[model samples]
Target: MTDPTLGELTVGVEGLALLRLLHADDRGAAQVARAARMAETREVLERLGREPSLRGPLGVELGLREGYARWAATYDGPLRLFSIEEPPVRRRLEAWPVGEVLDAACGTGRHAVRLAGRGHTVIGVDQSAEMLERARAKVPGGRFVEGGLTDLPLPDAAVDAALCALALVHLPDVAPAVAELARVVRPGGRILISDVHPFLVQLGWQAQFPVGDGRAFVRLHRHRVTDYAAAALAAGLVVSGVEEPALTPEAARTPTTELVPEATETAYAGLPGVVIWEFARP
Candidate 1:
């Protein structure tokens, strides 16, 4: 019952037992170590814009929320994706007129703290209370509320601006969440939504986390650029700007294989790492 992802890693004979142990729901050191290695390797693959295997727990016991419940504990730690995404989000925020802010799917207050620190009245919303607890601690002034993207617990046209960062990938479709985002922001207010680039998600990169001893992969939808545009159009949110920010100039052009394999570096070097949408309610 080894995780299907291990087939890609081929972690060697010593890792077979580890994989089996993880498959059996045993979170022992061997399993944990192997899972961590796999996750790191997957991250490297994802960075190179290759599709990483997304296999993990598969059943009701392994719901996305449950996995995040475990992932919430370390949601704000040092990870490549965080570093890759945070800067672009910050840069995008600079162009917007900020006031009351909504941090939809605000995990661990990572971006919320920064936005709040910039003097925006930030309200962080997430499904995981465990994640919200850390968010609350990170930005005491920012309101932390437990909610999902599909049904946000907020008044209509309530906020001046909104942000849904790297979260729409979890949804089966972007429309529901986009509608919610549109519903909350006042007319003329801006909404900045960032996500794993459609190209990367189409390449099979998954939303996952190393939780407890085993790994947890939340189900994700592969959304294209058109899907986002359609959702916004249908919701009546006017598109103001679309940004496809790449990795830092040095890293994107370096052609280095220190982290990723040579083939992947060749394939994806200098490519856009994330997709950002700036929309306004008219």
Candidate 2:
């Protein structure tokens, strides 16, 4: 028999609620939280020894456009991932030349606003119109466009620096996007790409957020560090630096209403949580 509210409790905050219930008694909730974290409601139910009433894929691969449209509203609202990302990204950008900058996949202009404020002429691009709209408002003087990393609507060698934070893993193959980034950035210019380290993915963790009743998981492709290096080298970009920042006790202590509490807080205690790469267009 199905848990009557299983559908509502399988994704996002709702899903966490279910786990919190189980976590009260079953230490295994942590395991299930990661194993079934962002999968389909029915599938998770089946794993939990129950029959589901609704039958379907756990979550559709929404691609970038539809996915961002759904995610834009809450992109930076309920969750607080910047705590893990901002410090390293800001550090990398600090050494970059203050010139024309491109924030590829500039979701909600989080980076754009920061770059523009620091005297860099920034153009933000993303595939989601909704996100671009938010980006436009967040950085009123900054230019925001709707496009993608693999096919940016920009001329070759157009910018002095480009920052694509946490966007590459969404692609099945990374070569074309790296090639595209290489093409757009002038020689000696820089490109910084960040992603959730592949180790967590291998352990069944995923990037997920709540939709209506359930959480929607971002369809992610695990890219080993070697894969990124290979793509960057083939694209004529020099790999200047690679930083794999592990989860910190400080960040974990930071409070948040994050959905789906996986055992990773403990399992990933001292493991890499993010991979930030710095590349030179030369």
Candidate 3:
């Protein structure tokens, strides 16, 4: 079969028109249009917009108005502080005798670049073409593919190790992604996944604050630690270890503290912003 056309693969002109109408800004519209050309972006936005829970006033306020855009901007600053730095996850993978590594949902190729730098053949996959473009620029030697965590295009047992960092929370279902991760890695190979702690989701801290009212303060997605484990088991993987990385007090300081005082340095340092799990495909 021929590959889908760019318009067919993406949101198409119709969705782009809606985005333009909602945003009411040419710049945002242009950006959305550009992103919609990629299959992943089209899928994500369509899924997000089509959810029943995401309709009505709350949906308009949270999703269409400025929710995703706000979160997207935070990736450069406040969110960056909470991201997984090179050393911790990198050390664990480098210690293993793996050759080919797959960085699923490899945002900006941070970990993928590090893995490649350590002489591992790494392939980075993400749904966002915009993100993959950035990843390609950052990690020139590594291969970057456009795909979702649930529907990977690679063959079965294709890699020695697979890593996913801070990407699963956005997915509506974790089981499919977990199964895909297992399917792509060889038996006894490792699958490392790190995501925002479920506790943070339960606490309703995933949503941005300082909205007109607190209506958007509630949790927007379902995230449970047990579900993650179950997904792994169903995918025929054994959980080897689970770890929570603590953030330094200094690293937690940010301007958003004014809006989320409860998320102060002292409070977050004791909580798990990042949770890492090791799964062995068996």
Candidate 4:
């Protein structure tokens, strides 16, 4: 049999690069490559497309370039929608008397733009270049650095206040990142974090199709509220408040709802889809 054509080899190499970026593990990439040989690349790609992470499901087939680019492009829309509606949250943020603010994990610059508009000097940091690109377009005045939560590029005690909105849930261990946030802010500076309630994280979601007796196919990491508080404390931050804001009764009738279903909405109504916590470095 003739050897595979150069185009086929190029495709396979591209697949390998995608696998490497998705897994960030050499052993895992090798295993995925072996599996792809048994199953066609197209089939592999189809499976990964369903997952949130690059390595998720048919991710290998999607290839690194396309998968990463798509993630960067689509991330801004949902983030803006979720953040723009929280007027109370925004109000509290505006109340803080700080000239310099660091919006850590500031996806799409929703909060960053708001803060900048209020005349505060803001620096937005995020790992995804695509997200940062969108954020830059939205808030040209605010400085944006492309980096992870655990390692902020800013100097020590660089900012008067730091805000992390709906971004902690993505990190594997919230402690180190929290510590980094605390370290960057001056003594008595405040840190605000908002994320999905722990209960919501525990209640897993089902796929459209049944997989393994119709059980929840994916289990998201649900870090406890107390644990998060402890992390803040360990990082030398004093917790001031923890609140679960209510969705207005009138706001409920709107066609675009943040709540998923009756049960979920009820649960979220009692417990917030967003939890806001305030901390101060002593």
lDDT of candidate 4 vs native?
0.63
lDDT tens per residue, model 4, 1-282 = 442232333234345334434543477765665464335445434544563333323112222223334455545434322642466568779788958999998867878888988899999998767778888998888899988789999899999999998767766678998999999999978998887566645642111112233211212356887878989989989998777664433322111122112222222233344577889888
Q: Give candidate 1 misplaced runs (Cα > 4 Å).
A: 1-3, 9-61, 212-214, 247-260
> Weakest 10 consecutive residues, lDDT, candidate 2?
252-261
The sequence of per-residue lDDT tens digits that candidate 2 reaches over residues 83-125 is 6778889988988768999899898988888899899999998
What is the lDDT, from 0 to 100, of the residue 73 in candidate 2?
93
Q: What order do candidates take by lDDT, descending?
A: 2, 1, 3, 4
For model 3 the local lDDT of residue 215 reads 32
Residues 151-188, model 1: lDDT tens digits: 99999998999999888988889999999999999988
- Model 1 misses residue 138 by how many Å? 0.8
On lDDT, the stronger of 1 and 4 is 1
lDDT of 3 at 270: 48
- Using TM-score as the measure, name the better of candidate 3 and candidate 4: 3
Per residue, candidate 3 scores C-alpha lDDT tens digits across 74-186 of 33343533454344676677776749999998866778777888888889987766667777887898889988888997999999999998778777788999999999999
For candidate 1, report its TM-score.
Answer: 0.74
What Cα-based lDDT does every candidate model obtain?
Answer: 0.72, 0.73, 0.65, 0.63
